[model samples]
Target: MKVLVTGSQGFIGKNLLAELKNKEFPEILEVNRKTEQSTLDKYCKEAEFVFHLAGVNRPEDQSEFMDGNYGFTSILLETLKKQKNTCPILISSSIQAELDNPYGVSKKAGEDLLFEYSEETGAKVLVYRLPNVFGKWCRPNYNSAVATFCHNVAHDLSINVNDPSVEMNLVYIDDLIGEFINALNGKENTRGDFCEVPVVHVTTLGEIVELIYSFKKSREERTIPNMSKAFTKKLYSTYLSYLPSKQFSYDLKMNVDHRGSFTEFIKTPDRGQVSVNISKPGITKGNHWHHTKNEKFLVVSGEGVIRFRRIGTEEIIEYFVSGNKLEVVDIPTGYTHNIENLGETDLVTIMWVNEYFNPEKPDTYYLEV
Candidate 1:
């Protein structure tokens, strides 16, 4: 099928084209600002489907709204009529069309024109009265509050929230693309006056700002945002996209001593924590017993012997492990434990604990094992 996408360089237009390519659509006719009028005419003459996404939402001149929104629709429809071609054309309209402002008026005018054309020539038109569509690739500080918040927070810049109580209805770009593909396959979600993207999320302005801000602080705090909800998952993904490439990796706090270094990897409230422990040759560490907190020590590199002894008892248990044959030794509750480097090289062990360590109320106490 020949798919013609106006404003192909724009956020939604770019995402739609990528999805079409992923689906292996044969031909795509991309029309952008730099593309000549003659080229658009040629595309209209051959397009089997059209995505009319170009519009003037943030024009310098207010009068340019009508010209770019309504006037451009007129030109595109006229080209389609001149060639006597009618394909399934989708129009990206705004929910603001329900308002009485100039931009809204222009968008409503375009919608009316499409409805009239569909009525007259039996041409299929799907007009989506979209809400604040946001995702990766959207311009920051331009239109979307989500985009602006993500960009600013990722860059360590402050974001302004004018109305904390104001709630926004957002649709992720991936969801929009999925819906567009559904329409292309003749399975659109339509109602009386327009179509809608099925998945939508709503959050107060303050909540959004706070959530995105926490993402920037996650590395320092060693915490992760709650991702059980779909909205947060999408928002987190979008936030990561805005992070500078240089800031992609973060440093972990390591506890170093003469024996070796113990670096915390990741910690979770529900899933406990993981760390890497390096032991110098002939060095021993963790001569301690936990009342309730237990751990798993996996020898990942070099050779090691993990020793465990029941508290208040003389019995000792030992396990020999090495990098060549990986093994995990569990430190049971109420058992004193220690790990010793058995080889000439440093021993590296991956450690997992049942909970995040707390200095004030550590369940560990020094003991011989």
Candidate 2:
């Protein structure tokens, strides 16, 4: 399919065009403010589907709103009409169109024009009255507060919260593209003259700020947010994408001693914790058994021998592990286990426990393995 996307360099345009290319659309025509009329004429004549995403939200002069949103739309449609083309056209409108403002008025005028054209030519037109759209690539300090907040928080800058109680209706970029693709497949969620993205999230302005703050603090906390919630998961991923390239790495606290060091990598309330343990040569660790704090240990450096014995039985089991052949040794609840460094170099083991340690109610008990 030959898909023509207006505002092809914009946030939504970039996302949609990438997805279209990924879907293996044969040909794509990109149009932007700088696009020549001759190129638009050719694209209008050849495009099988038109994503009318070009619009002006912020302009120094108010008249430019109409010129960009309504005027450009008129030009595109008229060119399509002159070419006698009736391919499907999907327009990205805003919920503000219902209000009486310059931008809203321009968007509404564009919608009116598309409807009139659809009526006159009987061409398929899907008008989307989108809420605040956000995700990666959205321009900061633009129309989307979510984008501004994510960017500001990721950069350690202050975010303006004009109204803490104000709730925002957000449509993710991926969700918007999914809806657009559905419209392309002739399966639009339409009602009257407008179409809708099936999935949207609602959150208060204050909560959005809090969520982003938590994401930044996750580095120091060595933890992750609750991912079972759909909105949070998507928002967190979006938040991470906004982090500065140089800020990607964060330091973790490591405890070092003669037996080497141990560091907690990440801790989650429901998923337990992961830690790195380094044992010095000729040193042994974990001559203990747990009632329920089972663990999985994988030696990633040097060589070690992990020995285990049933709590009440005399039978002993031993497993030799090395960096050359990585393997995980499971420490069962009723088994006494110990890992001893056998190589000349220190042994580094990645460990995962079913739960984090609690000094008040430690499940471990010292026992010879």
Candidate 3:
């Protein structure tokens, strides 16, 4: 199908085009500000479906709102009429269309025009009165507070929150595209006079700012964001998209000693912690038993022998491990355990503990295995 998309260079348009290309759509007709009238006429004649996404939200003069939003829409509809095309036309409108502001008035006029055109030509019209839409590629500091917050936070810049309690209804870009694709498939979720994106996230400005800030600090804390919530997961992905290219990588603290080094990779409050341990050749580590803490050790490189002995028992258990044949050794509670590097090179082990180490409690008791 030859799909036509206006505002092809915009945030939403770029995302839609990417998804369309990914889905292996055969043809796409794009119309941007610089596109010529002759080309638009050609696209109008050839298009099987239309995504009328071009509109002006911010302008140098109030008169330009009507010119860009309603006037351009009128021109497009007239051109389609001239071409005798009555394809499905989906328009991106705003909830503010119900208001009396100049932009809202322009958007309302555009919608009225579309309705009239649909009535006259019997064209399928899908009008979406979207809420505050957010995600990757949205312009920062212009219209969306979420975009501004993500950009500023990722860049370590300060953001002003005059009213942190201000609530917002957000539609993710991916969700919007999903709805658009559904409309293309003739399965639109129509509600009264307009169509809906199905899912909307409601959150306060303060909460959004807090989440973005936490994402920035996550690198330093070696922590991952809780992915159980839908909004948080989407917001976290958006926040990472705004990170500067040069600042993509951050250093992790590695504790180095004569035996080798250990580095904490990731820590979670409920899921415990993961660390990378390296031991020099012929070195044995972990001559201790824990009262409650338990761990799992995987030998990922070189050769090693893990030895274990239960508390108040003389019996010893051993497991030979090597990178060539990977296996995990479980260190049970109340069992004194140690690992010796048997190979000539350094031994690398991946360690996972059931809980984050606490200095105050220190459940470890020194014992030989």
Model 3 worst lDDT run, 10 consecutive residues: 264-273
Q: What is the lDDT of candidate 2?
A: 0.93
Stronger candidate by TM-score (2 vs 3): 3
- Candidate 1: clashing pairs of residues: none
What tens-digit string does per-residue lDDT give for candidate 2 at 165-204?
Answer: 9988999999999999999999999877689999989989
lDDT of 3 by residue, 132-223 (tens): 99999999988899999999988888999999999999999999999999999999999998998999999999999999999999998999
Q: Quote the RMSD, in angstroms, for model 2.
A: 2.0
What ranges in model 1 sit over 4 Å off?
289-291, 294-300, 303-336, 342-346
Model 3 misses residue 57 by how many Å? 1.7
Candidate 1 accuracy as lDDT: 0.91
> Highest lDDT: which candidate?
3
lDDT of 1 by residue, 255-355 (tens): 99998999988776677888999999999998999988989989989998999899889999989999999877888999998999989999999999999
lDDT of all predictions, in order shown? 0.91, 0.93, 0.95
